[model samples]
Target: MDEKRRVAAVWLPHWPVERLYRADRRTRGKVQAPKAPLALAAPGQGGVRVTACNRTAAAAGVAPGQLVPDAMTLCPGLELRAADFAADRAALKRLALWCGRYTPWTAVDPAGIGEEPDGLMLDISGCDHLFGGEAALVADLQKRLHGFGLTVRVAVASTPGAAWALARYGTAPAFILLPGDEAAALEKLPVAALRLDDATVDGLMRLGLKRAGDLYGKPRAPITARFGRHVAQRLDEALGFAREPISPLRPPAPFRARGIFAEGLTRTEDIEEAVRLLAGELCRLLAHERRGARRLELTLFRADGEVTRLFAGTAAPSHDALHLARLFREKLAQAGDDFDAGFGIEAAMLAALATDTLAPAQDRFDAEGADAEALAQIIDRLGARLGHERIVRLEPRASHIPERAVVSVSAVRGATPAMRGWRAQVEEQMAAALAGSLARPIRLLARPEPVEAVAEVPEGPPRIFRWRRVTHRVTRAEGPERIAPEWWRRGERRTRDYYRVEDAEGRRFWLYRDGLYLRDTEGPRWYLHGVFE
Candidate 1:
């Protein structure tokens, strides 16, 4: 059996086409803010000149290499503005996804934007039978997308090259083909059908070989000699004189559930009922396909033509509709409060955005890992209520400096690391040291506050010292554990002598003195910082 394909091409008018005007520029809202490309160059006598025109912009009477002033003069009352590349790209991607109903295999054309991604290629293969044969399938796609006001041209052929050529060059009932007749069908088509460069096409036209048929009947030697190898090469491939590969855009991730309400569901209960039915439908499809979902997406259509999306992820793959419904309950509940069912949802789609493979869980000696799942659910709930950042897990950073350690991550998804082996022992020791010594204030100042002090000793306990306008008498003190500042870091480096001192009130304090007494006029100063409760 010969391989037959039904390929459909959608013309994104915004896509660069030569001299063809695009009106979609008006759709550029605040997000993109694209300027209009056409403007009335003053009510002119004949026509207006183009100011800044691209190939597609020029095709609309804004020709390339044409002076903007001349273009405005040629076509008066032309709307001039900047092209919104972002909006155009987004619309193209949406069109690709919309094409899914026709075939699982659809690919975008090599040409984009200025080149105008003319159409998409679909290797319908065995799938066309589901839509009641090739012609009906094309008709169905045309009817649906045309409702959206899209201009589409489709062609079915034995090879991608033949289909592509006919779509661009042929007319409607836009498809053309005959079994084992590739050469004859493409014979009369222009050289442009082979997707050759503009320079090549112009050169071929000048040589009086305007059509593929003209070149097909002529001597091979002279055509190659005049236009070089690339021209003849593309012609040969399009005519199936050489093998041409078809790279269809891989079908997007499959979505199994589609919901259509009986009377357009308006109430929350009605929507939930619809959602449950859709989830069940998806679950059945997933089971039949022998796959499980990791992430599920629910798309809700509001009566007013608004689409709302909800997303959920599982720790493991699942195909249970009830479980999926539970995950969506919170979101669906909220949607009822916020959404205005202007027309009632016309359509809804339930899809597994991600899936994973796994074997069935066996009965365990102890209860399975529900704790982790429950915690995840709670965290997710808290994150939804209070911004995600408000609920976080503190992860210890591998640094000795207290402030350098401990980072925050969303509590819902992050896993706490186990402090095992030497690390665990060190943490335990640090905990013990803090707990046994004294009750320390939770907030520790970044650094000690320096203060001028007078001690009675020649290296003995201080009799009196004033710190921040408070006088203190140190009755006893322990020897200092001197610490030197890091000299490599260029700044005011210092040496510290720390002491555990008891004041006259018998209250213990941690104090440090910066720099040793030298011949400099300044004396050693003490600083009281962190409090030991």
Candidate 2:
């Protein structure tokens, strides 16, 4: 039999209130404030409604979704604060980062409609022993979080669903259910503890199924047919019959190196040295795995609890430690004053965010391939200094139209293989595609300019034309090659008759008559489309 994995859930019952309090304290620089009832509200149809409330507000008969007027009536001195969802989400992300010390795999539960998230899920699995045991870990987490002025409930179980249910509704600050004990431990909990919606819970209650134990032996078909598959799925997940996966906010890197300092270092040289050391260690890891990083991230954890991150990308996959360090140096130098070492950096972590397969290249005695590699490195450096968006190359796209045939893309990512092949084929077939004519223009106008011309007939080539106030008399005329619009596209379907004409001064011009003469329009319009060498 496979060993059961352990999971832990950390529930913060008053996250919104705590976040607001923290912000207020930080802005005011006051540790102690008035202990008045407070509530966060959002504009609703009737009036502003309470979204979250502190314990004091709850004790004064205020609840979430309650109208602000009613809450105010219940507590005359109630303090109502507008909710800051962005700040709350940012705080949750930072908390998830801080939790990285406990477990590498941690995910923040997304906030539900009309409710802010108050919990995080962590896959502890085989990591419980590091803090002595599961019970010890729970105690340590609770104690440490309590120092942050948060009221937290910690629970551990065999499944994420069970751990989440027990952590939020287990009637204790800390709870643990051994493997195979989930059913018994969750028997008396309310049906809502299964993560059901309010309507489902109310419907279940109306049917006299008030607790989880009441549905334990019932027929699955009847319940699922009435309440839907989610009910059965959640139940199964809690009982370990169905798998529930947790997606971490940041995926753990395969190659990582970290440095911890006893005393924070503030000097740029010290930080660069630390980065070099981490890059060396990371490159060693990549070497062992026979891979190279395409993108690297350097994270600095400040002593003042701020986190700074820097990113560098390579044109080609690279595993050389010195080259990677040099790229970071260039990035940092370009960052200049933006990369602030606020109150010094206590720790530095280097991670290979994205990687690719890299095989050892055979050394060459000549410098034939060396120049290409050097050029790629130079492009990489330029991309790191200026943003990648600023360093772009024109790539051929799959289009027959002159203007739509080419596009701009990041130089670091290179061009698509299909586009390159298409361009090559087009170059080889130029003569045949142009109908045996070698009069293709050297420069094509972005948008054709209208020209006044007098053709020999309504359907013939131009004989005299006035373009940009200059009259050109055609001495040689070649074609009336007809081109049609793409039928698949919507809009006006105009056919163009192009002509390669040479003026009396030996200057060649490509002009086209838009629309068939008297077929699609009353009179055809002449346009100067291109200039031939």
- The top-ranked prediction according to lDDT is 2
Q: For candidate 2, lDDT tens digit of each residue in 1-533?
A: 01368888898888888876666665665454347899999897798899888888999999988999999999999998998878888897887776665566888864332456778888888667767898888887787567566778988998988888898889888998889998898899998888888899899999999998888988889888998988888888988888888899888877888777877888888888999999999999999999988899988877545578889988778788888888888877987887888678877889998998887889899996697578668878888888777888767765555556667778888546854676585676685666675355868888899999998788999999999999999999988777776677678578888899999999999999988866885578999989997
Report, for every candidate in turn, its global Cα lDDT versus the true structure. 0.61, 0.82
TM-score of 2: 0.69
How close is every model to the real structure, measured as TM-score?
Answer: 0.60, 0.69
Writing each residue's lDDT as its tens digit, candidate 1 over 323-345 gives 67767776765555576665566
**Candidate 2, residue 32: lDDT:** 47
Backbone collisions counted per model:
34, 0
How far does residue 502 in candidate 1 sit from its true spot (Å)? 12
The C-alpha stretches of model 2 lying farther than 4 A from their native spots are 1-4, 28-30, 43-48, 65-74, 85-90, 97-105, 110-114, 125-148, 206-208, 250-254, 257-267, 302-306, 341-348, 369-372, 392-409, 414-533
List runs of model 1 lying over 4 Å from the truth.
1-7, 12-94, 97-136, 156-160, 174-185, 213-251, 254-368, 383-390, 416-533
